[model samples]
Target: MSKTALITGASSGIGKELAIIHAQQGGNLVLVARRADKLNELKQTLESQHKVSVYVIAKDLTNANAPQEVYDEVQTQGITVDYLINNAGFGGRGKFHERSIEDDLAMINLNIVALTLLTKLFLPDFVKRNSGKILNTSSTASFMPGPLQAVYFATKTYVTFLSNAIAEELYDTNVTVTNLMPGATESEFAKTSGMEKQVYLNKQQRHIQ
Candidate 1:
């Protein structure tokens, strides 16, 4: 039987691309995103193309209880997640002190708290079953301090560090954790983070060369 994978932020960008890749590999997918329409569109596309089952969970993971709610929804539907992709994230840019505190907190909630909570809640079954895979999305920004995007950078650092530590602790187990640290990929990330257009262009140029 094909493994079932749950992916957050499945409405767009890397998350959506990962969903496509999973479907290509003959995996059933449970996609979560705040946008119901986009999720539905994705579900249709994946199912039609791959002939695989697709489920969509529309949620804003910034809510403190959202992760548990997601897990509960999956259990309600009797979906056993063999793969979990914690790819949901948001970014804050510009001067740290000048940035909106609400945005910063939301980023913290999604990028760190929700991801960790989901991992903790779902990991027990994986341990009991002795088979599972987790892929957490970190960024190259985790390596150095981001001047304009302070909170976003810090949150990714936490993700990378926490994921690596857990991976080590689960070393000999059947569970495997992988972190993908893309170096400023071509996505809406720069725009959402309020990065300067020129800076984004420069980065894109460097990425291509």
Candidate 2:
């Protein structure tokens, strides 16, 4: 039977690429993102091209209740998620003291709390069934302190550690957890984080120019 994957942040960036890959492999999808339009568009494209079912859930994962709501919705739809890809997160570029507290909190909520909650909600079912895979989108920033993007880096550290610990816990089971630590890539992340003007990006731009 073809598997089903639930992918958050499915509207754009790496999350979007993951969805396409799963579809190409003949797997069904539950695509979650705040942008319904983009989700629908991807759903149409993937379904037409790959003949896989795609369900879109537009939600802001920063909200405390969003993760639970997503879980409930999946249950209501009678979808058994075979793969859980927690790829929804954003970063803000600024010193910890200068950045907006609200933004930082939202980052924590989405990057840390939402990922943990979704894993918590889904892993039990995986354990009960003795099969499932979890792929979390952590970052290279997890390794060290980020001078400007402090909270973002710290949140990624939490993700890396949490994912590692849980993988160890499930070693006896068929379930698996993988953390992806990608460096700077061509994605919405740079623009969303306001890092387009940063030195590295500027240097890259100059080279391209």
Candidate 3:
């Protein structure tokens, strides 16, 4: 049977790759991202190549109410998201104290706050029916403190712990939570996070969305 997956940050990077993988398996998709153009582009390619339905929701998840609005819109559209993949996040490389507070806050909003809200919004449906899955795009940075990217690491730590806790909570049910900590990739992340000029902290640099 073909399942319907709703993935955030589906415009690029791991999220986009995940969408492609799912489409290849004949699953329908509801892709959420700030870039409608990218989402539509992916939608067209996936629909043509895989013969699966693609729905695009363009909203900046950094906003406080975006998560709720997204949930409402999904409900209005009568889309049943069988899988929820929270994969949108960014990091800044610099001393925590030296970095701009606004930027750090935005990172928290996207990486931590937005992810949580989306999970909260969707997990209940999964629990109600004793099915569904959640895949959060955390990082290995969650495992320890990151000096240059302190805030980013902290947010990921929160995601890891949260996913674990929720997984345990749903042990009696069929609902499951999975956390992904990618090693490295070559993406627009380094350039956007202001890490391009810095010495590479880890070997096998990662691709970002």
Candidate 4:
């Protein structure tokens, strides 16, 4: 049977690509993002091309209650999610003190809080069934502290450790948690995360990998 994947940040870049790939594999998709128009456009394309059902949930996950809301909506639809892809995140460039507290907190809300809550909400179902997969988009930045992008780096580290611990916790079950640490990629991430203006991106060509 084809699986169903619920992916966040599915309107663009890595998230969009993941949705497409799942569709290509004949899997249904529940795509969540902030832009309704973009989500609808992607939904139309994926449904027409892959002949798979695609549900769109346009939500700004930074909101304190958004993760729970997403979970409730999914439950209402009666869609069994075989995969949960937490790919929604953005970074800001600046020294820690130089960055606004609000911005950094927002980063934490989405990168850490939202991801954690969604996992907590869905993991119970997976555990009950003894099946499911989770893919969280961490970053190589998690390996060390980032001088310019402080909060973003720290959040990814939290993701890495959290995912690792959960994987071990579910070792006996088929439910699995995976962390994806991607290096520099040419995507909207560069532009939104302020990495495009950083020196490293300017020094080398960023080809899609």
Candidate 5:
């Protein structure tokens, strides 16, 4: 049987590319994103090209109930997940105190809370089967203290550290966890974080090649 991958934020950016890569490899997909249209479009494209099954969950990961909902949905469909990608995250610009409390909370909910919840919910199944792969998307910003984007950076640090620690704990198990640390590449992240000018100019000056 083909392996299955569940990717959060699969509608765009890194998540979207990852899904495409998995599809090309003939892996079945469970794509989750807030945009149903985009998710459906990707499903069509992948199924037509790869001839692999594609499932979509259109819901906001920031929701407290989302993790369980995703798990239950997968169970109802009799899908066995061989991989999980926690790639759903967003950043907020400006000082901690200056940013909107709601936006900061949403970032925390998605980046930290939601990620942890889903990991915990899935770890048992992966452990029981003694096999699985997990990929969590962390950022280079996780390595430093982001002044303007304080909470956002802190959340990513949590994700990276958490993933590493769990990976160590599961060292003896067949499961493998990898935290992808990607430097600023092209994405909607800048606009979403309201840091377009800052990220763009820095990229242009550094010519990150």
Candidate 6:
């Protein structure tokens, strides 16, 4: 049987690509994102082309309750998720003290709290079945302190550490956790982070993995 994957941030960027790849492999999908229109569009396209079931959960994951609601919804649909891909995140480019506290907090809530909650909610089921895979979309910024994007870098550091630690914890089981650290790529991230005008963005080349 084809596996089912529940992927956050499936509206665009790396998340969208991951969803496409999974659909191409005949896997069912639970796509979660804030943009219903985009999610629906992707769902229609993927279902038509790949003949796989696609469910859309349009949600702002920064809300503390969103993770539980996603888990509950998945249960209601009786979808057994074999893969959990946490790819919903954003960064803000500014001095840490100069940025709005609310924005920084929202970043933390989505990047750290939401991801952790979703993992907590689904991991038990994976352990019960002795199978599952988790892919966390971190960033190359996790390796060093980001002067202009402090909170964003810190949150990703947590992601990388958390993913690696959990992978070791599940060493004896079939469950696996993988962390992907992608460098600058063609995405809305630069514009959303207010870094589009930065000199580094223009000069930096996309990292080839």
Candidate 6 residue 120 Cα shift, in angstroms, is 0.4
Worst 10 residues of 5 by lDDT: 200-209
For candidate 5, what is the lDDT?
0.93
Cα shift from native, residue 56, model 3 (Å): 0.2
lDDT against the true structure, per candidate, is: 0.91, 0.95, 0.93, 0.93, 0.93, 0.94
TM-scores for all predictions: 0.94, 0.96, 0.94, 0.95, 0.96, 0.95
Where model 1 places Cα greater than 4 Å from the true spot, the runs are: 196-209
> What local lDDT score does residue 98 receive in model 1, on the 0 to 100 scale?
94
Model 1 lDDT at residue 174: 93
Clashing pairs in 2: none
Residue 52 of model 2: what lDDT?
95
Say which prediction, candidate 2 or candidate 6, comes out ahead on lDDT: 2
Predicted structure 2: lDDT: 0.95
RMSD of each: 2.1, 1.7, 3.5, 2.7, 1.8, 2.9
| Local accuracy of candidate 6 as per-residue lDDT tens digits, 1-209 | 99999999999899999999999999999999999999999999999999999999999999989999999999999999999999999999889889999999999999999999999999999999999999999999999999999999999999999999999999999999999899987777887778888846456653431
- Residue-wise lDDT of candidate 1 within 1-209, one digit each (tens)? 99999999889889999999999999999999899999999999989999999999999999998999999999999999999999999787678899889989989999999999999999989989999999999999899888888889899999999999999989989999889998867666666666668576887999999
- Model 4 residue 78 CA deviation (Å) reads 1.1
lDDT of 6 at 110: 92
Index of the highest-lDDT prediction = 2
Best of the two (1, 2) by TM-score: 2
Worst window of 10 by summed lDDT in candidate 4? 200-209
What lDDT tens digits, residue by residue, belong to model 3 across residues 72-99? 9999999899999999999998898899
Give Cα distance to truth, residue 113, candidate 1, Å.
0.7
Which segments of model 2 are wrong by more than 4 Å? 199-201, 204-209
